[model samples]
Target: MTEERVVGLLERLLQAKVGHDVARLIEKRLGRKLEPFDIWYDGFKARSGLDERRLDAMVRERFPTTDAFQQNLPAILEALGFDRDTARFLAAHIEVDPARGAGHAWGPVMRGGKAHLRTRVPKGGMDYKGFNIAMHELGHTVEQVFSLYRVENTLMAGVPNNAFTEGFAFVFQARDLDVLGAGGADPERDACRTLDAFWSAREIAGVALVDIGVWHWMLEHPDASPAQLREAAVKIATDVWNRHFAPFMGVKDSPILAIYSHMISYPLYLSHYPLGFIVAYQVEDYFRSHPLAENMERMCRQGRLTPDLWMKRAVGSPVSADPMIRGAERAVKSLLKH
Candidate 1:
């Protein structure tokens, strides 16, 4: 079911030629023709316009030390609608630490041990990117706490897969600006956000196809050397780009998709990101009409169901691109009018 849903969405995306149209729109927005590497285009995001140094300054002031961030976790949770008791409970179980590398969450394997949220914080302070990553990891820690301490079965103390946790992390990451109390309410930004999400989903879907295709190529040439594998990787990435991206971007056989470091280090793991985005969009939409803190608690406590069942239980729908596509279409129309 999951495979069919993902493949079906990919096929529909290709057939609809939405990428070509969106590319033209993006070019208009940028005042230049699209480049092949524009597959990673981020100009639609509201934060793209903000000065990075200014944002970093704000974050550094807010979290001057790792302890500052750790101390504010309860307040952060409460700002997201958690009651004081629940916020304190979550904050108590999560230990924030400065990371030696790019940040990640480490959930406790046993009860009573704390979940670690690690993100890089320089000696001076936490930068904007570090703060953003910390919020994402905090989402993972929160979900870990709920799924571990709140679930009925100890054996089932996690979400179905890493993708679901990534989804939850994305939900928190999306609210980073809100947590900072930085942006005023703007309905127009919602449309921009939808377009941003659609473009992102399309970009990662192409990368995922390349990732999957390379694995299949490896299977076909079992005795292939490292040099041969490198060649095959580039070929596979180029082929995928031609099929999915060339028509839209006016480029042929661009090996740009092969640029992801994960293609070298993490085999067949790229699909989870696009899947996470899909699940995150659905989860975010659901939370718009429901209480995020309460719904997230109930959903996380569901523990280790199949992905489809977990999503259905959490959002009353299976994981699908329909909502994102529909929303993007409306956004595109609205954007063109203005």
Candidate 2:
């Protein structure tokens, strides 16, 4: 069910004429023709054009130490609509630490243990990227707490899969600017956000296809040498790009899809990202006018049901790209008309 829904969405996105139109719009915004690597375009985001140095300075001033970020968790949760007690309970259950790597959330294995959120903090303090990552990890920690501490059964103590957690992470990541008091609600901005989500979803979907194809190639030629595997990986990536990305990117046989480190380091893990985006969009849409903290607490407490079942319980529908696609289409029409 998950595979069919994701693949069906990707196919529709690839075939949709809006992909080309949105590509042109993005190119105009960029003041250049599109390139194959533009699949990862960031211009539609509000922060894309901001000076990183300025953002870093702001973040450093706000969170000069890991403890500073940690101390603010309750307030952050409160700002998202959690009551004082609920916010404090969640904050008490999560521990923040400086990470050696990018950042990750480590949930507790036993009751009465704290969930850990590990994120990098440089000597200068947490920069914008680190803070953004911290917020993402915070989302995971919150989900971890809700799913574990609030769940009725210890056997069902997490979301169904990584994609669901990733979706929750995105829910928090999307609100970084809001948390900083840097932006507010606007119809145009909301529309752009939808388009941004669509483009990102479209990009990773192709990369995932390549990831799947390359693994299949490996299975078919198990005796192939390292050189042969590398050649096959590149060929599969190029083929996937040609089929799905070339029409919009105006480049053929681009190996850009194979550039993700996960393809080499984390076998068969690429699909979760695009699927995460789909889940995020659907979950976000469902809670658009509702209280996020309350609804999120309820949803996470559903615990380890199957993905389709969890989604059906959380939202009114199963995981599908239709909501996001329809949103992007409306956004495109609205943006282009003006």
Candidate 3:
């Protein structure tokens, strides 16, 4: 889709009304008025107040080594709502590895090859953080396996872009607590989850718009000096933040939007992330009532279609911010009452 459509949808979600609701929600949680840095507020997460060390201890007892987690991969998938047969199939086609640094998923390019999930495993054991990363990477493998082996075209064996795959990963990542037997379907926690999805999308949407602006600037000023480019980028970032973020955040001309290193290293790829957040919210919202295993497989099999088409065929609606905003509005209203 055109950047214009994406921009319009993101802007619609970033409306001052929704921003105000988000501010109120944050303030309610923090027992204070909004601050400039409240833009990174994560109090909406279900695990924000839970003790991480207790979780780590629990995880270590359950999975004291990489092999322990690898062997229980099928059980983890089953815990995330997949059936036994499907979970076994997925687990059989995926391998988990110990990593020295950050975690990531690497899908096999060849047919019949297993996907590799890499996560840091301390000598002491696999902690909660490592297990969470494994869940996210396992989500990627789910998409990769279905899209590659279960689709019509292995040649074009992928979703439309990076966003959709990343989207699926978020779907699984968000349920890490549920897998650990920590999260539940309590009304307040569910609402917090919905609002967290919307708020995250809102935050990244501004940074993404700034990314788009910098890309367009480079296109228009191919001959400009590096210093000139820097000046224009900062200007674009401040303009976007002032317009979208300042009204609620009470921060003016904040160049934080342009501070992402992706703007420097990746070049025009930053938009994929906000799109990922939106798609994840959309997909997770749909699966709330639908059969997740069947529908997730069905959606992945529609490989590489136009995003809107894929969304329509998968969910009943097009990819828009309305659902997210409405969900947030309901969440904020519900949360502020208590």
TM-score of each: 0.94, 0.94, 0.95
Better of 2 and 3 by lDDT: 2
The backbone clash count of each candidate, in order, is: 0, 0, 0
Q: Write the per-residue lDDT of candidate 2 for residues 218-293, one digit (tens) a residue.
A: 8899899989988888898898888888888888989888887687688878888888888898999998877798
- The residue-level lDDT of candidate 2 at 247 comes to 81
Can you write out model 1's per-residue Cα lDDT over 114-137, one digit (the tens) per residue? 999998889999988888889899
User: Cα lDDT of all candidates, in order?
Assistant: 0.84, 0.86, 0.85
Which candidate's TM-score is highest? 3
Clashing pairs in 2: none
Off by over 4 Å in 2: 1-5, 49-54
What TM-score does candidate 1 reach? Answer: 0.94
Q: Is candidate 1 or candidate 3 better by TM-score?
A: 3
lDDT of 3 at 44: 86
The TM-score ranking, best first, is 3, 2, 1
Mark the 10 consecutive residues where model 3 has the least summed lDDT: 16-25
Candidate 1 wrong stretches, greater than 4 Å: 1-5, 13-16
